[model samples]
Target: MKKITVKITSILIALAMVFTFVPASVVATEDVTEQTEQQEQVEEVVTEEEVVTEEEVVTEEEVVTEEEVVTEEEVVTEEEATTEEESTETVVFDDINHWAKDQILKMHAKGVVLGDDQGKFNPNNNITRAEFTAMVNRVFGFVAQAELSFTDVQGDEWYAEDLAKAVAAGYIDGYPDGTMLPNNYITRQEAAKIVVEVFGFADMSAVEGNEFADFAYVGEWAQNYVAIAKEKSYVKGYEDGTFKPQSNIRRGETVQMLVNSTGEIITEAGTYTEDFATNVVVRSADVVLEDLTIEGDLYLAPGVGEGEVVLENVVVEGTTFVAANANLAGEFATVVVNAPVAVNIVEQASITNFVVNNKAAGANITAIAAMVFEPKAAVKVNGQDVVAGSKVTVSGGGETVVEPPSSQDPIVEEEHSVYEFSFELPTEIVAEEDVEVAVTFAATEVKDLGYENVRFAFAVATDVEDAEVTFTAVDSEGTEYTFTNEGAWGPAAGFAIPADYTAATDWTLNFSKAGTYTITFQLVTVDGEVLVEGTQEVVVLEEATIVEEHSVYEFSFELPTEIVAEEDVEVAVTFAATEVKDLGYENVRFVFAVATDVEDAEVTFTAVDSEGTEYTFTNEGAWGPAAGFAIPADYTAATDWTLNFSKAGTYTITFQLVTVDGEVLVEGTQEVVVLEEATEEVIEEETTEETTEEV
Candidate 1:
């Protein structure tokens, strides 16, 4: 009951948010555009009344009690579940735009909608002319075609009238041929025209002013409409200042854009005042990590900029620290780092200036302790590679500089480093005739792991044709055994699994006990970082194993009659299931609803001889069920044929009332069957054995 209530509430919230968020000048219908390479919006449409009325009673008769029961049982054994059908299928919504498919439909019976000619919407498919027309028709009741001026449009065409009406209703346009090009892929311009027209906006003269980069491509006729849309907050440009007017808007972006455009942006602007002589004050919640420049004045806003709003170029003069991160919210707020971060932040907690001394020393630092000078292992520690990124223990004098603990938050690669690998050689002065092993370290770094097995990450690349770069882990203490690419040494593609290494494995790859080990990644290189390139270091923190998702499926059935071949027999069947472990599919139905119509139904002749010997008239070959055979035909006609379920399982069955629309939905089932009892010996064995097994 709680679950159902929550589901209903979530749907209501979504619907309300959508309405409040839509812009002032625009009204949007529930849109489900079919795009080949993009996902559609996840819409939850709840009635307005339902959103307001919390006290409304949900009748018990309408509740799916079986789901409640199944939900309880699903708490166990879900891992063993598997999909039985070879073909992939999903449920279809009653409307053309559906997230899931359903059988034994009711929405269609209410005259609210209709399925495609095949009686299936092909929910996962792209939309076609006929289908889109049908969908549009369902949304807007069929109307007499308003006379169209296009010569290509004809009354004889099935969709001709619909295309004409859609245009007449200001939904689309047609060429001079009178033919509305319904089959062409909808373009951005065409889409824009429809949107403006639908929103009841009249075409206007082009904006006779300087156009920003965002509106550079807007058509002359559509310029005024675009301007109005912008002023009314109906659209936004990308951060790069390009509106991408001609590009097809993605489904996710479309939703977000719609939300931003329509919602009221109320902001309570205030100033944050702080002393910048000692510290740096960031008024905006999000601060960039990149270097920043503020006018030679330092002052915090008297108070903070209050409210959920996209903060843009807020002015901050005086001393300032530019955020290093390329992307940060609230990029502009006048402030400064009057002093270096290290000195100021430590002593004065309230100081707004960042002095240069706050950096961690000794074992705390990582980039320095682990260094790969070559461009291959281009590891950047804050700013400096060798000195800055190195690990350190104490600061004032010389302290123990070793690896720290494992990295809790691992360093994620923004992009995959591309490289060419081969055993080819350049002839400056080679050791091996074919190749020379010149160690070039890719970018490297160590992670913060609170003293766990401290590990570092590195990358390697080469131009050798069947080339696999190997890392030879050597002791940082001595120069005797060195890095090599000979044996198993490279990590997995994701750099998750380490390759098996033999020489110096103890010092380099082995983590026999949780202690700090300095790992240096080296690769044989030829010259200035061209053949190979990548980040070099990362710290491994912990090992975790987890299982993802689980669910349950159960189904059962039995034949209707034993010997009623002379008359039509209504096959009795039911759905009953419970979930265990929930590792797989829930809400699974038995595929046993195949009705035996006159064409597919059959009656055959067969009898047993009265004597000890038996003779058969019509052989049972090719007799029962389609797709593989079942329930031998030689048995008495209609002798309650044993039905095969989509899957095998022991499910508790309970019938439910079903409805076409609102009438008494299907009444609960009366007849039920439990799996037959096992043999006494079998039961005894199961009880005695270490592991009980069932078939």
Candidate 2:
């Protein structure tokens, strides 16, 4: 083509030389200059010569087609604007940081786009037809509506279904020869057309302003779609003020455009109740919502800012995550139920399968009236049954309290038959005393399936060494159980029963030392399934026996339940000498010593007589005898003692009666404690002189 142009220009220059006599050579030079300039215009035309050559033969029609393509190409120039090579080596894509950063990352996180096997996004590489079609299918979850027979798309190919779906969705079509050419790079205009169809934006009017300088290059058939995309901010022109319509769309740009069309990018704080029926992305500011229902997961995204979400009567079918650094606040019923915190069914709310986990601590879940149905056995607060109408305070992670179940509440238990056991014991028993207990166990016949084996387990709790438990009609077969040595110690013990055996057994127990003792029993089957459980209590009393040489006086005392360190504890002893025969016994005194665990605490005691006399005693013993107060000869029942501890620990306050010979007659001790921090009154008393000396 260049040779032909050069020859034509030479002939024109010679003609000009012959026609003009004005220095023929100079005239020829001017004509040649003009002709050369004209030839430069033709040579400037640039087309993808490689594509034409790949098609091979050049017929008359092909030549004309090439000229037209060259003409169109001549108008476009390599972009002169220096594109900033936005760097993001930290992002999934090495070159994904410019206009496509937000959109690319957003879609990547949504699992909508994954880079190549090399983990390179290759943001500048043109996306293949298959790649673009797959992205469109993912965005809309479109399925193939009909079979596709594209010559280039095989049934077993990876992108066959995506191609079929694209065709079914009326977004793409095969060539005249039934070839999809899925591996072929898709153009910007082609992508715009598919995106418009998938997003249902075809009905939208074309945006008025053709802001792109090269907008005229866009095919007439794709102008409307591209215009809509530009208006919606889904597609943007280069900084050079041109939208390269015929340019191949890159993989990164394709995903970015797809995400932009979805409108999932939230930039402000507000409740979204658009009924997405799928996962909702939460970005941006704090949000508050009520009565909103989401059919899918709710994600609290990162990098958005500090977010506080409040949900009221909201329902999420999928998981709801209040990610770390984010705060979720709301009542149980309105919050995410079935999570760490169980839902609250307040007042007339129908009962559902309920569970109270660690999250239930400080959580409210009570009803104004009885439940319509009973909750499941798993309904518990820290592993304990959460009785209806009871408040739960979760402390120390697992500790919890369950108030007695209301009598008006319905019972929730399996309808399985099991043995029932009961025990009866005297409530009051002296220390170092023996006690007897009668137990009754019964199991009704379940029509059939008689039990083959039954067991009874018992445990004794006390600070005593010599203890015994014996079952009267003992039998291994028709077993009558017994324990002669120290009954099983620790928290519990187990016992067993035989098949078809039901009887009452007398359990004799004895304690050699003093302290409170409690006996509990669990009746279970051979398989270790608990049938019935019961507990019986025996308070082993500690009595002070006075020597016959001195007069005897019996008295009881009560002290402060709690005392703080550095605080004065007023302990008023209300006593009367029942037998005041010996004037020596009449003059009673008091003493105190630190308990073994807290013997290091420096405790002091001051006793005051009724007539206004005070006697102070220093803490001087390590769990030993410490001298205390001596009541006046005319001392009455009203005597007060003040105690102060320098450290926190348990202490024993002992009361002693002195005879005339100055011999200690009888003494009794009770336990007391000092807390870590000083109490309100203790702080005040430490700072002031006035003290409230009350019992």
- In order, candidate lDDTs are 0.30, 0.49
Clashes of each: 120, 16
lDDT of 2 by residue, 94-212 (tens): 54533344446655554566666555565445566776666655554443344554545556776766666666555665654445677666677777766665444566797587656
TM-score of 2: 0.28
Poorest stretch of ten by lDDT in candidate 1: 16-25
lDDT of 2 at 312: 51
Per-candidate TM vs. native? 0.21, 0.28
Candidate 1 local lDDT, residue 388: 30
lDDT for residue 100 in candidate 2, whole number 0-100:
48
Best by TM-score: 2
lDDT by residue (tens digit), candidate 1, 1-695: 22222234333221111001111111112133343433224323445544433455444233321111212211211111212121112243432222121111212221223444444433333333333433333322324344443334445655555555554344544442223445443323333444343333343343455333756676665566555444433454443444445554322233222322211111123322221211222323232222333332222221122211121232334333321111112223322211111111111112222221211221111121212211112222234332332342322222233333226643332342332222222222211222232333322222221111112233433333343333434444544333343232332111121122112223232222221223234332111012222232222223322545332323334543232223322333432323445243222211112222234332222323224343222212222223322211121122122332222223222322222222322223223222234457655765878464432
